[model samples]
Target: MTIKKFQGRTESEASEKAKKELGENCVIMNVKEIKPKGFLSAFKSSTFEVTAAVEEKEKSFDPSTAFKNMPKAKSVNVVANEKIEIPSFNTSPVKDRVITPAEPKADSAISMFSRTKEKEEKELEQKISNLQSRIDDEIIKKEIEAEDKAEEQKSSENRQPTKLKRKNENFEFIKTLYEVLIENEVDEKYVNQIMDEMEKVNWGGNNVDTILSAVYQKMILKFGQPKGIDISKKPSIVFFIGPTGVGKTTTIAKIASKYKIEKGKKVAFLAADTYRIAAAEQLRTYANILDSPMKIVYSPEELNGAIDEVKGYDLVLVDTAGLSHKNETQRADVKNLIDSVDEKYNKAVYLVISATTKYKDLLEITDTYKEISDYNLVFTKLDETSCYGNLLNIKLHTGAALSYVTTGQNVPDDIEVFDTQKIVKQLLGGR
Candidate 1:
């Protein structure tokens, strides 16, 4: 018998390959699907291997009468071209042994054929024992591989939940942040815009700290840069204008004290708030404290005259009357006061607003002043309100640069340059 193994991409293909090489009479001994092993095995293809055997033709062999005269055995049954397991027999001298009649003459063909059959059976048994040993080894190897695979699969299953839990935690953390923004009175529109921007960033890991840092940086960028009074020019005229009772006069005094007392610059006060006598008097008090010049201008012509008086001064801070945004005549007066400044001198406008104002009123006030002139933002009364949403809202509404934020009525002491980081941290529920 001749035996060989053939392989193909599938069982049928392997069978066909074996048949093509081993002929139609070939017997299939075994068929096994061979799978690639290891981590990258999933990317590879599996194959089938077929072991086949064929019997060689013999001219002297006669199958019809070969075993006709052979004596029957009690334990053995043989099949052609198939593996057989031989039974073990006791070989002790005391054990019973079968005794048969004497064989035919040695010259006879039957006697010679019988001896050949015995020799072939012994050789076949030896081959079967060797094949069984190989099969046993392969079975043990496959079992160990299967156990290792099962352990690896269990480990993978154990680790899957940790990844899922972290993802869920990240989602909850973001949700909490959203709630914090809402609770802080941040406008829904701006809050959504911030969250949408955060989503667009490609953070390799969705760690909570990483997400928080990203959100902080994004808000800081959105706030842009805060610009204060620029006194680089020989004379800088800064106009403070806003609606009624938003701390316009006091904010001006604070700025004046900062430039006059702290920096020792040549500062002057121009009070354009003729509608309120107390407003002019309040500014006069601050001007007297700093020993600076004070001028009250009632019209555009008066404003130009007042500008000439303060020509040699390094800084001129103007305080405008706080009036209703609905009053068209007052809005026009403030606009004229700002436009009356001489072109040769540098001028800056600041729109003072209160932090405690309602968002709706803030929108209206900012919109009204936007038509007057381009201005920077100054938010006052920060100590009265815990929520600073209006500050951000007005800043975005006007697209104006933020200049100063005052926490109290104290001149210069309660005021500081706009701190974008501090405001963002408070918005995100941090101290």
Candidate 2:
């Protein structure tokens, strides 16, 4: 008997293959559906695995006159070419009987049956040994073939490059740029927009550097320009709101220090962040260093009083408690505090975001924040990461302009006013 496995798109195809190899008499043992593995297999359909077997046919057994025509054993002596009359044994206990020479055949055929059975056993053993050897050889051959196929598959996979490797130079540039944007945590939709724009350009060139510059220019055109602080009143109220640990307080301090020391404009600190321990003290410490007065407001009414205290000052930088976007009550409270401010003071709200945040989370946070307060974006922790695609992503997503970007922890020196050319340089991996 021999067994083999065959696979094809359909059961009929697999059965045909099995029959071609194992003859029409092969028996179908098992059938199963199987899917291939690997990158390309994702697009391929499943196949059927069919196990079939074939066996050598054996002769039918006969009982009556089984050894009547059996050949005489070589050990038996023939007398004058006469047929030899083999002796037969009687197993009955009544009387022991033996066949005489006159009897051509034995009525009790025990001895004759014993000799014939022994010869049949020897022939069956030889056939079984040959079948076992053939089965072993087939198994070894299949194993070797499997090993060779594995090696070939590994080699083919290793040699595979990007699917776009053979595309035109312009396409290569666009693909590389798309990867860079995605690596920088840019939103997929915005990345697609960039790609679509890149595809529209009529320019032709293979130089990667040139293509990078072209992409940078296109981004700049899309990002547009940054908006400056709106200090149109005596005390322009600028509120900084964002998720916890995004450095909202620090960013407010930076802007405050810049206005007070460098620009010589009167600036006061107002913090409504009573949730965290020593939240007010943190701002007080910075205020003390700059010889500026700091005020802590616990409620909306107190926030109104704080705004009145800073009415004579040129600028009022307000820092609210960092709340998770998931906390709806706290976010609404922050929005109420901003609403309580006097309408006389020109208001400018800035949503402080961390540059290191993932694009998906940023989108969620911004979406939630947009429902509470409309504001321009202020990005912090630029020094901590290299991915700036989020900057353009947020800009395009919210239709808001960027105001300030903080590079490091320094109070006055680390903050930079948003500039288009500078941003283009940063986006292109420049210093």
Candidate 3:
């Protein structure tokens, strides 16, 4: 008998392979399932191995008779029932071993087939369990991602502003008010600050007229009233200082005429401006017209002596030289000259600024003169420019008490004490 083993993934496949290799007459000796071991256990699958066999029958021959009937000329010989031996040329001795096939155990094929079926069922169950877990994980992940996306979208929608009812009624009103103020030369920063305050308070009940009325009231509060002159000190020394072309001389003349002619107070003039040729002569003309005593001082010592001579007068008005704040030497000279005034005299310093001057220049002049004197403000040339924002701008920045505003070139007639309501009305586009 010749035996061979056949292997396949299953018992049916193994049995088919055994029949194909061993022919139709082959008998199946055994069927077994072999499971992989060691490192190959994870990768190699369990396989069914079937042991099969085929019978080979031996043939008997009358050797003695065949040898006797052979031809004499032929070299071949056949020996009958008397044992015959064959001779070999090689002299090496060798031992021979026999390998026997094991007999099939009772009902082992049926038991192995049953074990393979059980293993297949277990593998199917495991695969189904893994697939179910993966599906569950994917579903949970998708749900969480969807929820997060929805929350993020909702948060973004809440942060963005929605459309307002009545098409943002207050927006156009506030915009128009802002434009009008800016066109009239109000500082953009000031306008924006005011607007921000209004928005904070939610003022004016959705009407432009009401809003403007509230704004005008706010302006009155910010631009305060003028400070009055102090009458307690005898020979109150009033000094005028500022930039050129701002009418410092003319402003002093207005105050002098008001005190001397209208109020019937004794007033004297001291001219300390030697830089300008006509400055002293101009004041002398005003002094002659008002019939007030006028003196020209060449130095700080003369200025002190001039103050002494005017001691008996009710007021002493000192007119200073108009020097540009850009002139370092002249500014320092003016500062030093004013510093020489005696403490015995009551002094009031006044800075005269032009309303027609640029806001930037006005601020510079105010800052420079601050080093020379502590003073109140007086704005000139109010009649020269339609834009009066410069007056408010300077007052807002300098924090100086405004004493007077000169409307024109006329001495007493053009000058008026700083009136807050009148200026605020002009700023609001009123009379």
Candidate 4:
């Protein structure tokens, strides 16, 4: 038996050379970079690390007889054998794990060869090292064991699909909207009736604005008209509350504009939307447009103080924060603010709604906001929507009377005193 080493310009080249020298069956056992042998090696020289490896020959032969029976293939070249006696092999140690020897008579010869090969420490190390290199688990450097690696590989190959996080988040969002609507006690009649109307459209997803708009529409349609504004009532402090960006500020401007010019009534505005700088700026701009007085109120105490001070004015509008009904903490805080104002002055609560919000969201927004606002309805953004059904729906369901309808951002031009027929015409797809 003999072990041989081969090298070439590259690993593939070495592999080819090994195959040419030994046979295609030759397996690589070990590979390493050897220092280049020429003057050019000094600058940046490199050589292909290679291993031309084979399990040495081990077979018994009636030396002369085996040679006579050898195949006459062009790949094989055999010389007539002189005399040689092959030995019997003991294979008990590696019985379970070893690969089958190439030939039956070679079995005994292979055992003897392996024993002799093991005795040479450097050669044995090289063969074992080559075997280890071919094992194909590059991650062993991280201290991961073979069993864990095999398990990880298996798991990766057969991964299972789970629900998408985005879809889960959307479902959760929709669920929350419904919860807020329920919390508002938005009249079970209104919810069922709005759902019936919404069934006409597709509620297949969780679109918050669209859902909120629909609910708001239902409430307005059912109960939006001013059952009665008591002109005789004292210190009418109208507090507007609902979801953020539903046009609370704009609605306040509309109401203030109407009274200041149309009725020739004195109007003063208290801006409590100081949560955002831009929000305050927006109201201030409205104040400038209408040429009305606007006071920035940070708390309900300031609000009452403003109410006390604006006693000569015929109407006082308090602009509250645009709150999310889904946020309980914020909703409760708003509730406290509304209670504070009412504790001192007579609070005329108005729920400002947008026509673009969804039915479910409207229910939630209504339910969440009604805790702070409970007098009547003021709808905004009429010109931006095609669905008037929600307005009809909310009014018919919520039992809150309509106070005003806002068509656009124009202070005087965009607003309309609650006209049920005009709104109904618009709801029915009229111009």
Candidate 5:
């Protein structure tokens, strides 16, 4: 893997630089705002610094060739070592036996009868000999088969360690990776999915780098690409909604700052979070700082009116009251506010969540909002937690596009477009 860093006036620019230099396959491993340093730094804007990585391609290893040069076991020949002997029958007695002429006719008849009996006995003896020979042949065949089997077993025993060693190595590496993911709080279900997917890959060897690269790529693909605010078309209204104390207000401020200050887009703020006086004031303060218009509306009708006021603006970010997911009334209020938006306006909803939230609560929170609207996800307080499994968990569960993530309380500076590569690397225990 090759890792390097690039800087630009914006994150996308820096990312593009990385991709251009490292090839399009390069992934952004980390992203940070590099604040201008020195005495006159306040006059200069901060630039984005991104760490990017790309796997170095190498010749593929063929597993079939691992034992291609092994010595072959010699063939066994059982019949070459043993000799067989056959017993000969004496026929002199029959030839030498004389027929007496005591009574010419009677002696001749008696001799004929004796000769017939001798012939019958000889035939019976010949049959026994043939049967014995057949038995010996069968015995030799069985002995030969047994020897061949023994040789094959010995050869297998000799080769077993090499095969077993490779298997054990692969198993150990996978186990370690599994443990690392679990330790980082990745859900067992997702861990199993990742490992199962790995099993399907035709990785030629158990090299740590190869396996890690495969897993990293799988996770990146799982995360897909993150979609942030779209300003390609003017007059876009974005609504921020989530549970209480999830930093929704602060997140809105960060995004508003990015657009108004960095991108120079005409930004407006619509504060529907009338339940909390401080939330409204917080947004107002940000609006004042950004020199953008701010409005406070208590009803869906008022929100639509506020939207109309910002029709000429490039972007309007709406902040909704954070309420318990269990409260159906509050949920309905949010749903109504979103539904009240005029179909003529292009609107988007964002579900802001705290990274430190428990996985179970995250699930419940995401499930609740899912009933209200099809919104994108924006995670906050990422600096407070080391385990980012919930990020992946919620993303997978909600199947929502991840937008921005806030790392601290610093407006604009603490927030950035969700870097899937960074989160995936952290999940895999990378720095």
Candidate 6:
């Protein structure tokens, strides 16, 4: 590195001057403007009175060892008539003699003191420059990091939500049946065929769960369920996604209650849906009833950390926001929540649907959620429905399987294991 000062020239011109003498790689650390020459010198502008003086920082930055790749300096002074007045500046020129660490003696003390003073001043200047460079580097790095974060957030915001809109509610019957088909572990494609059939029928007001369970069993007997990831040996962590105010927190509570009490599994709830004021409170309300540990994760980073900390539990349920089925961006946002934690730890995702919803609305709901759904469909409010044909219809549209069939708003009594034949008989008003 070199400090090349070219008077009456732009920075680029100063660079060229330094390069002509010190080769192309010679770094221009700084530049300074010199005073104009005497009265006659000022008038003769074209003759060039001001001279560009470049000094090599040899001892301070030795090419031989400082940087292994530095080219060997093979420079010669050019013959220029302009007398360069050595500017008496704050910094000492490198031409000053090296300060040696000689032992203090009566004869050399005075001289040593002078050298020590000079050395201290030079060292102080060097320290300041080094610190400045380090600070500049840190600022640059921080700026780059901030820009990257902003870009990522912007990209996330630009994405549309994943839920599809339910148009005219025509496919409701099929959607209901599709939910059941998925629960029975039927193949996704066959379940979809059922949806196609149910769509042709286009009838409204079928019971979501019962019909779904029936068609699901039929599809499984005929086609077979989608290959579900085995979570028996591993940890059982689940995430629930669906439209808003559809009993997401309640369903989570039901699952936790059933597992902890009936199945005798250790359960914990991690409340990831911090968006709503009552969301976490509602989950807490359930947690209090089940007497299982409930934790809230305010950030994605926190969510990941909590999952790591809450190991050794039999079941962990992460609850998400009740985003509109019509909003697509909500998919990615929900995905971030899923990704923030370990969804791979998740063996199952439960799509909770209200059994009271109409058949066409049910179809639209399932279709809207089809893109991101791989979990089983858990239907709630089954007691509210007389017609269970919608369940059959849901099995036809979305290929999700049934995990549990929720009947009422009751905590323990309203939820049940998805039994195909029993549900069909019950739906038809048979014993």
User: CA lDDT of each candidate?
Assistant: 0.81, 0.77, 0.76, 0.64, 0.82, 0.62
RMSD of each: 13.4, 24.3, 17.6, 23.1, 39.2, 31.7
lDDT for each residue of candidate 6 in 224-264, tens digit (9 for 90 to 100): 24332234744666888888877888878877887789888
Q: Which is the better candidate, 1 or 4, if ranked by TM-score?
A: 1
Model 3: pairs clashing at backbone N, Cα or C within 3 Å: 64-80
What's the TM for model 6? Answer: 0.47
- Candidate 6, residue 71: the lDDT equals 31
lDDT of 5 by residue, 1-431 (tens): 65667899999999999999889999999999999754446799999998887776643344343234222323211121111111112322211122232333645644454455556656776887787677767867988999999999999998888777776787788898899889888899999999999987744345667888999999998887899988766689999999998999899888888888888899999999888899899899999998999999899988778888889999999999999999999999999999999898888999999999999999999998999999999999999999988888888888999999999998879998999989998998888
lDDT order, best first, reads: 5, 1, 2, 3, 4, 6
For model 5, the local distance difference test gives 0.82
Residue pairs in candidate 2 whose N, alpha carbon or C atoms collide under 3 angstroms: none
Q: What stretches of model 6 exceed 4 Å from their correct place?
A: 1-231, 426-431
Q: How many clashes (backbone atoms < 3 Å, residues ≥3 apart in a chain or on different chains) does model 5 have? A: 0
lDDT of 3 by residue, 127-177 (tens): 877776776678679889999999999987765433232125567777776
Lowest lDDT sum, 10 consecutive residues, model 5, at 77-86
- TM per candidate: 0.72, 0.58, 0.59, 0.47, 0.63, 0.47
List, residue by residue over 277-390, the lDDT tens digit for candidate 2: 587888888899888888888898887778887789888888899999999899899989888887777888899999999888998999998998888999999999888888
Backbone clash tally (model 1): 0
Question: Could you say which candidate leads in TM-score?
Answer: 1
Give residue 242's error in model 6 in angstroms: 1.4
Model 3 spans with C-alpha error above 4 angstroms: 1-170, 204-210
Q: After superposition, how far is residue 144 of candidate 2 from its true place, in Å?
A: 68
